[model samples]
Every structure is written in structure tokens, then in C-alpha cells.
Target: MGSAWKQLPEELTGPARSLAEELRTLKDAAGLSLSELATRTHYSRASWERWLNGKRVITEQALDALIGAVECDGPALRALWQQAVAGPSGAEAGAQDTAAEADADADAPRVAGVQDTAEPVEVLPAGEPEPATAWWRRPAPLLACAAVVALVLVLVGLRATRHDDPSTPVADPGTSSAPVTVPAKPVSSDPTCQAMGCAHKNPKDTGCGKDARTLQSDVIGKVVIYLRYSQKCQAVWAAINEGQPQDYATITSSTGESEQALIHYGYDNYSLMLSAADPAVTFQVCGHQPEGNLCIAPMSDPAGMVASTPIPVGPASPPPGVGGTASPTADATASPSAAPTAVS
Candidate 1:
């Protein structure tokens, strides 16, 4: 049988082409047929077809599902997908626009009495000077402009050849008039806090969730616990993906700092972050259920393996300067619960 895939449209360029090609490569590497992908992921075969064929922009949720199904680098893929959503680069768009205008001009209707074989003539209003007599079009001015263009081209060529000349002196960083550009370090999208300042702050609002990853995950009874850590924020938090009403998870640092998240109506909830710059300091996420308390810590494995320890049911000790108010849950609809007060 012939290949099921169609060639990406010729108009696709820049990030859009990149993302589509990367998706195709990942699909090929996974060796999963479209039918199998539909069964495994939330998106149907037709949705995958459109994304892969560059007919539609892929949603974040759809991308996440595909990444999970293929086990690819989620962060890198997400970044590429975001660039694609931002559309083509400025230069590419300009070129495309220019080509479109040229095509439109080619197809546009001509003047009523103008002959196609004749040299184009410009029409001028009565009493106006002809463009042929303009000062800028004079021989001396035209020669000057040509000379300036030639000088620019020669200078550019010399600059391009400078790298190959050993006699060329390197510019001193302190004395050079040219501006030296330093690559910018990655910053959180919209983080309100950083490092210690992030303590007791909402991970989502602080933009730490953008680069967060599950350090460890465990399933106790029906509840699934995700021990999430954000290297960018240097903070850790606990998320309860599945749980009962009144269920909660507390993220506590080895330094004795803690924050709790309560689930009131839904099965999902996430706690506020606790500053944890040092991974060796140890951060634990303990989920509280009616049955008992189950705790898990970040493992050395990058695979996010969860090793849990069941502890007796009890309230966690709160950090100093922290009040009884538990940071609000991720679900805004649910009312906040009475948090565990600090004990002296």
C-alpha cells in the first residue's frame, strides 16, 4: 500500500514546519500506527492526521497526550510547539507577503489603452514636473548613490574576511565601541517570586508550573500523588491527581517548612510551594487519606519512580512564621478548609 501521509504544504515554513517535522519523526520512532495512537491517546486518528500534516495547530493537551504516548522529551517538544503557535519568523512572513503581492500584481487588470509590449509610462498631473527631470534622478546624484552602495559592499566583504586574517587585532572587551551581546538566561514566564521568596506561594500563579516536572509519583488506594519540583523556582510541591473529598497533601521540606492543599469537591488539588534550593536537603510529599498517611520523596532515578512509606495518621508540623491558613487549592470553586495551625 502507498504511504498514508501526504506531503506538508509548500507554504509551511519556520517553526510550523519544524514542529510538524519533529512530530513526524517522533511518530516514526514510536512505530505506532494512527489507529493505535487514537486508541491510546485522547485525540482521535483524524486529529493526529491534521496535526502531523500541518493542517492545524496542536493544542497543549493534545501535545501532552502524544508526548506521553511516545515517551519523548516533554519540555523540548512543548517549547517547539509554542514557537509554532507564535507563527513564522518576521523574515519568512515578509518574504511570503512579497511573493503574494507579486502574484497579485501579475494577475491584476491592466490600463484600458496601454499596450503590453510598450515601456511603462508614468502619468503626471498638469503643471507638475516629470519624474525624468527630478534632481535625484540626475547623472551626478545617481553616480553618487551607486558609489555609496559599492563602498558598503566592499566594507561588508572586508568585515566578512576579517576572521581569516591573523594580522587583525582582536577588539578589547572593555575598550571596544561595539556592543557585545551576552546570551540571556532562561527566566520563569511570569513568576511572582524566586528562591526563598517562593515559599508558601502558589506554584501556578508564580509561573513555576511552566517548567515543573514530577520528581516522584505514587498511587495509594484511589489517590495518585505527584511530587512536583521546579528547578527554575528551586521549590517543591505536592499534587493530588485523584482523591476523595476532604483529602489533602502536604509538601514538607527537610528544613521543617510545610504547606498543605485540600480537596473539597474534586479529586484534583495541588499545594503551595516550599523553597528547596538544595535537592540533597530532601523534600517529602505526604498525602492524607481516611485510611492513613502515605509519603514519598524524590528518587535518584530520572524515570520518576515512586517509593512510598506509610506513616501513622497525624498532623504535620508547620514552619515558623507560617500561619494556620492553608494556601488555596488549585480549584477556585471549592472553599478553603481550616488549615493545621502552628504548634509552639
Candidate 2:
């Protein structure tokens, strides 16, 4: 993937082509394969490849991730990406909208018997006058007094309750009046979603957890992904190993609700932190083309999924979604099968 590569489309002139060229150059300088890039960045490798190949425009998120990956924080690159995304298509869409509006106006119905019976609305009194006080600024001392009394009653009730319970220590009258401190989310350092820890707890806990269940992969395509769920965590996450640039994968629930994640040019591997998608609704994973064709081709349907009991990970499995793998894009790019060209 060295200097020589497939040429960009001739139609991709102007900002769009400039952006694509710059992205490729930046990725090369970073010295990371597409797969490695995807694992490190939020955007997937497949998505990035499409942008670099001039198949589609990249998103601002993609540019941001690319900037981070290359360790270069430049405003010019962002501007270029913006221009590319807002290319001819944007202007065309605007023109189309304008034409539609004009056509609607021309076709509007008119009746000869119609009469203009409209009335003018009154304007605000313009005479000079003193402005009234704002609602919050009004004199409300009695309201404040009532609120303080209510607070005191609540605190006193608690104090009396504690006093009645000999085992409970009554809060001292001199203690800080600030609200009592309470831990926000019950967090645990252990990644394992144990029954006790995950009970009534959020799926994404403090640390990376063990794989509670592994999904079977039947369809193999440009991208190969595996799903794993932790009953304790009550969550499902995926680790994708194989994929070309611009490939995207989506997880849809039994109810057709879905969450979509994208792959960028150098992105190879990815793992999703399951949260929104509910386990009660059976979920399916589908891979999509970076440009389109989402879920059009999928490895397997989620219908096969069943109630999985807690199966703690043994010594056989290491990382979360099977073992993460790499892509071959970089290897081909380094030697640059053809001529070296400048994007900027």
C-alpha cells in the first residue's frame, strides 16, 4: 500500500478529492494498519477506506479521529473535511428544496369568492413606563420561610427515627448542613460481571469484564464480528476482527431497534460497550457497506440466540470478543504497489 495505489475518481475533483488525498497521506505517516487504526479510533476501518478511496465523504468524527491518530492537531485538515462533506451534493439539495417550494406556491389553490377578512394584531404598549420586577426577584420572604420550616421538619423526623433506633447514630445538630454524600453509581474494579456485583447494576461497569457468552458466526464477509453478552452485566458487546475500510456493522434488537458503528480507513478491530440495546429483546448483528447496503448482508440472524446462563470465562479465553485480528491494507500501502502522489 505504499506510494502507488488505485487512482481516485475523476469526478472527485475540488474539496472532496483534496480531503481524500490528505487522509491517505496522514494515515501513511502514522504508520498504522487500517485494523490497528480502527481499534485505536472511534471510527471503523471500513468507513475510512471508503473516504480514502473516494467512494464517499468522511464525517467530522472521522477527521477528528484521524487527527488524533496521526498525533497532529491541525485546523486546516478539519476545514478541508468540512468542505468535502459540503460539496456539490449539498448545493444541489438546497437548489432542489428551493425549486420545490416555488412549485408548491405556483400550484396553491385560489378561489374567486374568497375575501380578505384578516385583522391586525395589537402591538405591545409602547408608552414609557417603569418595568416590572422579574418573578424570581419578587419579594417572597414568606415562601423562603415556609421552605426552611419544611426542611427542618424533614431533618427532625430523620433525627427522631435515628434516635428511636438504638443501633443508628443520630446526626449531630452541628454537622454540615450540605446534603449527605452518597456514591453515584456502584462501581467495581473487577471486569467480571458476577451475579452479586451486576445485580441491579448498569451493564458498563468500572472495568472490562469477562465474556459471559459468545455469539456464533455463520456468514463470513469483508468483516467478521463476534458478539458476547454478560447476563451479570445484562449487556451485549461485539469484537470485530476482519473488515475492509468503509464497512459498518449494526446491532438490531428483536423489536427492530438498532445501534450502528462505523469502520474507517485503517480501522481493523472494534468492541462496542453495550448499554442502550436491551437483552430482553433478542439482538442481531449485521455488516453494511460504508456507503450503503446496511444489514443487507449479515453473518447470522439473532433468532438463534437463547437464554444463556451465567458461564464464567475459563483459562481458554483471553480477551473479550474472541481474539482481535489485524488487516492487510497497511502492508500493501507501505511498499506502495505503484507511484507515490501528494494529496494536499
Candidate 3:
């Protein structure tokens, strides 16, 4: 068999001729018969013969496989492929000759045209192309988005203002108004009477004492008790001892009227009926005994009190005429007293 390595014709025209020559060279270098090369490359023997004989166009995949099998330099083969792709076909020899002549005589600068071979021109850099911006950095689009947000805020503000009462005027900082004067209601002596009458009053009065006075007492304190059906109420009480150290006290159902009560004895007769279903569970607050005896007062259910109603819980007014404005009197009138404690 003749060596597949044939010199490439100088007049080789298009890619078909170049590919055929390259394939022939690859087969020659592999030192394999056409059938053997075909088996290795998976191309049929007839197909390989036709491709190497310049009778048919060859695919780049086939050329690549042949190059890989032969271990040939790929860059050189690629350059040859490019040249063949740019060349005119054998049938267009006259046109190719004319193009060659024109290209050779191109001393003057030529206008841009499809076939202009101005040394394979590169795309212009568009005079330092503008840098790409982040999505948020675009001024027009960003401003539009900000305007939309501002519009939404303005609409929400307008809706809010519409719901507000228009008749209420904004208070002026410097304007002075007349002071609110809440008329003083006469303090009842009933609380004082109960404290003195209760017989279970601890001799030491530690159990039932002056701390059990009515809401009329000038004491300021809050007592919170957590109670369970079976468990004893845990009373956490705190009060200012401004006047004589007011002793702390608590009276429960367990403490009979005769027992010495700490704060107030009047609250002992009634038990707090805290309903598990009540939105706000009601607790009882009592007064100190020395000031007032067992006073049954229904306190706001602090467990879940929503602070909708204001209940005052202390002295009627500042002791007679104590100087600078007295504290507002607490509203301590609501009592759930069914069986009032009898003064002994």
C-alpha cells in the first residue's frame, strides 16, 4: 500500500482540501493501514479513504480524533483549518485571484468591507467601555424605586391622619390651664370601727394590725398574691413606712375573724372567687386592721388586666392641707362584700 503521507498541494483551496491533507498525514504518522486506522478512529475504511483522498469534507470531530490518535500538535492543525476556512473554493479560482491581486496592491487605507483583509481586525474597545454597575447603583432605576417607597409612606401617613380626630388641637407648650379640682368625698368611719372590733386581733397584733387600715390610710403599697385552688396564697406586699412603721398584713379565709391580722382585719370575711374563665381574674386587696377592719374589696384581675379601667386604691386626699398638690385620690369604692364582717 502507498504511504498515506502525500505532500499538500500548493493550490489547495478550501477547508475540504486542507482537512483531507491533514487526515492523510495523521494516518501516515500512525504507521497503521487504512483499515487499522479506521478501526482505531471508529471511522469506516471507505469513509477514511474518501476523506484523505479529498473526495469529501471532513468534520472537526473526526480531525480531532485523528490528531489525538497520532499525537500531533493541535495548534498548527487549527491554524491550517482557519486558513482553509478563509480560502476560496477551487471552483472560484478566478474570484480568488482577483481578491489576491487587490489585497497585494492595498497601499491606501481601504473602507470597511466584508472581504477586507486589514490584518484580521479586532473589535474596538469602544473607547474604554463603561464599567458595569451593581443593580442598586443605577441612578434612574434606584431613584424610581425610592420614589415608589416614598409614595407608599405618604399614602400610609395620609390614611393615619384621616382616622385621627380633627377637632383636638395640639397643645401649646407655654399655655397654662386651670388645675383639675376633684371634690373630696367624706371619709367613712366604718373601716376604723371594724379594726377596733375584730376579736381575733393578734395580742401582739402581728396578725391583725394597724396595717389593716382602710383605703383611707396614707400608705402607698401594692400587694400581689398568686393563688391556686389547693395552695395557700403567696402574698408579696410592699409599702412605704413613711409614717410610723406600718406593719405588713394579710387575712385569708383560713384566718378566722379572731386571728391577729397583719395589714387589715376587715378583708377576712370574704374569699376571692377567682373564676378560671374570667378574662381578667379578680383578686382581693384589703386594708390594715388598726386603721380599718376586714374590708372586702374587689381588686382588678391583675393576671391579665388590660389597663382599660383606672382604679384608685388609697387615701381620699392629701391629709387636709399638706402643701404642694396632693396625689389624686384612688377609686377604692367597688366592693364584692356579700357578708360584711361584724365588728366585735
Highest lDDT, which number?
1
The TM-scores of all predictions, comma-separated, are 0.35, 0.35, 0.23
lDDT per residue, candidate 3, 140-160, as tens digits? 455445544543454344335
Query: What are the RMSD figures for all models against the true structure?
Result: 24.3, 25.7, 47.6
Backbone clash count, each prediction separately: 0, 27, 36
TM-score of 2: 0.35
Better-scoring candidate (lDDT), 2 or 3: 2
Model 3 clash number: 36
After TM-score superposition, the amount by which residue 140's alpha carbon in candidate 1 deviates from its true location, in angstroms, is: 92
Tell me the tens digit of each residue's lDDT in model 2 across 131-163: 221111211366435434543554345345546
- Tell me which of candidates 1 and 3 scores higher on lDDT: 1
How does residue 276 of candidate 2 score in lDDT? 25
TM for candidate 1 is 0.35
Which residue runs of candidate 1 sit more than 4 Å off their true CA positions? 1-190, 297-344
